[model samples]
Target: MLDRFTMPLTHRPLASMARYLSNRQVTPDQVTLVAFLVGMSALPLLAFEYYVLALMAILLNRLGDGLDGALARLSGQQSDAGGFIDIGLDFVFYAAVVLGFALANPGQNALAAAVLLFAFIGTGTSFLAFAIAAKARNVERPNFPQKAFYYLEGLTEGTETVIALVLFCLFPHYFPWLAGLFAAGCLITAATRLWGGYWTLR
Candidate 1:
């Protein structure tokens, strides 16, 4: 959902970072590993109620996430294995982040946290289903890969949700409100993706 707004800024920086890392003999797989490790560490940070540190860790992880693909393109090392690892690790990281938040404020907002987690499952499954069907159909359209590169059209994506979660962490007083908002967005995103898949696979 929010990836497109960042593209204008991230594109050049990512390209430059990829070029630099590629020249330094760094592998995209290594970058992916490092990013996943950093993201995992955020779990403990959340356990400690270190909201600021968790936010920073998540941002850093996202930075690495963005760079991996660019690094792959620059290094000419794109592979199915790399993509699988990237996507798989991403889901784990996302779930961890949400769990962290839920644990952090469990006493006061268990219901909201559970709802958010449920929405996460629904949204993730919907997006994955659409992606699988679309790929199986081999429906190639111009700039379609850009959806993976930088998701802009959907109501929500990793980037936006991370930002929203971070904001909610910063403002815990509004956590339930944010959860409700995100839930609505998730429904919209699912519907949009279903429509897209229907049209693409028809």
Candidate 2:
């Protein structure tokens, strides 16, 4: 949703950092791996109910996520393999954080977490499935030309998800409500993506 607007604003700063890292001979894949590790660390923090620390990890994880792509472009080292690994690990990191919240208070959070994870499945599959078909048809991604795979815009995009996660950490007592609301948004995103993909392909 907000991705298109936020991306442009973020790109310059990220590119500057990317240029610095590129000069240091850092690989995009390394940045991706570090992002995953930092994101994964948030899982345990969440599980232990360390909301502030987990929030910091989440922010750093997102920072790494953005910088890696910039670094890839700066070094001219972007590849399908790098994008594949980056997105794959990102999904795992997302799931782990949800699980961490569920573990923190199973009696209150489990059901909501489960529902949210299911919604994630819907969004994730729809996005990837569209990407595959878009690739086969040679669809152009003017909005996200830097992506190695076809980029599908959605109602619950990266920006929205991050906002929801931040809310979860800040208002831990409201996790169930926030997760439910976000899950609904994710489902809407999935349905819209499915419809858009079908019409676009047809």
Candidate 3:
């Protein structure tokens, strides 16, 4: 939701770092893989009830996530394959974090975590499906033209998700309520995307 606004502010600094890394011959794919590893590390930390450590991992993961794209663009190595792996692994990472919460305290968090994951499916599918159709129709995404695939705007986008995850870590006991609220937002995002996609394609 806040991605568009944040992208401009973030892009310059990330690109600057990317330039330095590119000069060192670091590939965006390498950054992406490392980011995934770091992000997934939060899962174990969460399971062990290490909230502060988990928060740090989560922040680093998101930083790597943003940096990879900047590195790709700066190095002129952007490709469909890079985008594919980035998005796919991102979903996996998101799921893992939620699973971590559930594992941390299944008695309290399981149901909420499950519902959140289900909502993620809704948002992910609708977003990807719209992107595919938009591409077929030669539709442009002015707000996210650098993306390898079309970016469908949503109420629960990356920025919002990050905020929710941070909140989850800050107040582990409130995971159920936070996950539930974010899940509802995801559903709303899915519904709006679905409606917009239908009309645009028609």
Candidate 4:
């Protein structure tokens, strides 16, 4: 939901960084792979109960998420394959964080993590499915013109999810409650995306 605003604010800085990296011959795909690897490190950190360290790793992953896209555009190397890699790994990373929580304390967090993962299916499918149809129809998302594909606006977007994850890491004991709340938001996003996408497509 807040992505529209946050993206523009980060663009300049990310662009500058992208330009520097581009000069160094760094490719977007390379940045993406490194980011995913670093992000995956959070799983072990979380498993070992290093919440603060895990949080830092997660944040770096998120930063790289943005940076890769910026680098792609800056270096004029944006490709469907690159975008596909970026988004696909994103869902994996998001779910991995939840799994990390479950692994950290299975008795308390497993069920909640499962529920959140289920909710993710709803949001993820709705987002990707609509993007495909929208792209077919030449539908545009002015709010996210930089995006590789059109997507429905929703209550639970990348920004909100990151905030929820940050909170989860900061207060691991509250994972169940936080996961429930975020999962509920994902449901809302899914419902709205389904409804809005249907009408918009028609």
Candidate 5:
């Protein structure tokens, strides 16, 4: 839903970052691996009830995530391997954040957390399936901007998730409510993607 405003911004600094990283001889794969490690460490921050620490971890992880693409462009080393690793790490990191919230409030929020996880898994699966099919069919690959259907729409993009991360850190007590809202958004994303895939693929 917000992609129209956000997509243009995504590429603005990428080329500049790519130039810098290339000059430094940084590899895209190396950036991806480092990003994955930072993202994985976030799980422990959440488990230890350090919401602020987790928020910092989220930002660091995002930097790593963003860097891989920049590094790829800088090095002219973009590939299926690089893209696959980047996206795979993204899904895992998202799951870990939700798991962190559950760990932080297991007493009264476990159910909501579980629901959020289900939604995440379901919606993520739908998204990847559609994307893979679209790729196989030689369709114009749908960038997040093109996906009026799922993932990029609603309040679940990187920006909004970061905002939610900040909110979670500030009011960890409100985790349950946030989880429910995220779950609702996930459901809507899933349905929209599925329907869009049918129309586009058929």
Candidate 6:
């Protein structure tokens, strides 16, 4: 939901960083790979109850995510392959974080984590399904021209997801409540997207 608003604020900084990395011979794929590795590390960190360190890993992952896109655009190296890898890894990272919280306290967090993951499936499937159809029909996403996939707006987006993760890290004891709340939001997003996308495509 806040992604569009935040995109402008982040564009200049990410572009500058991208230019610096481009000059240093760093590739977008390299950044994505490194970022995924760092992001995946959060699972073990969280399992061991190292919330702060896990939070750092999560933030760096998001940084790498934005940087990779900036670097792709800066170097004119953007490709479907790069986009595929980036988005694929993103879902895995999100799942891992939730699993980490569950592991932190299975008796309490497990059910919440499960519900959240289920909600994620709804959001992820609806988002991708709409993108696929939109692309097939050449539907333009004017709001997010830089996106490789057709972008859809909803109550829960990347911004909201990250905020939820950050809150989970900051208040580990509140994982159940936080995850449940966020899951509800995600479900609402999924439902709206499904309805809107269907009518738009129909």
How many Å off is the CA of 192 in candidate 4? 0.5
As for candidate 6, its clashing pairs are: none
lDDT of 6 by residue, 1-20 (tens): 99999888999999999999
TM-score of each: 0.89, 0.98, 0.98, 0.98, 0.88, 0.99
| Candidate 2 Cα lDDT to native | 0.94
The collision pairs in model 1 are: none
True-vs-predicted CA distance for residue 25, candidate 4, Å:
0.2
Give the Cα-based TM-score of candidate 1 against the true structure: 0.89
Model 1: lDDT equals 0.76
Question: Which lDDT values do the candidates have, in the order given?
Answer: 0.76, 0.94, 0.95, 0.93, 0.74, 0.95
Regions of candidate 5 where Cα sits further than 4 Å from its true position: 142-155
| 23-139 per-residue lDDT for model 5 (tens digits) | 888898888888788877778888788877788888888877777776776577877777777778788888888888788778967898899889887678877787677667666
lDDT per residue, candidate 3, 1-202, as tens digits? Answer: 8999988899889988999999999999999999999999999999999999999999999999999999999889999899989999999999999999999999999999999999999999999999889889999999998899999999999999999999999999999999999999999999999998999899
Error of 3 at 3 (Å): 1.1
lDDT of 4: 0.93
Could you tell me how far off, in angstroms, the CA of residue 67 lies in candidate 1 after the best superposition? 0.4
**After superposition, candidate 4 runs with Cα above 4 Å error:** none
Per the 3 Å backbone cut-off, how many clashing residue pairs does candidate 3 have?
0
At residue 159, give the lDDT of candidate 3.
Answer: 95
**Candidate 4, 64-164: lDDT as tens digits:** 99999999998888888998899999999999999999999999999999999999999999999999998889997889988887857899999998999
lDDT (Cα, tens digit) per residue for candidate 2, span 1-202: 9999989999899999999998899999999999999999999999999999999999999999999999999999999899899899988989999999999999999999999999999999999999889888999999999888998999999999899999999999999999999999999999999999899999
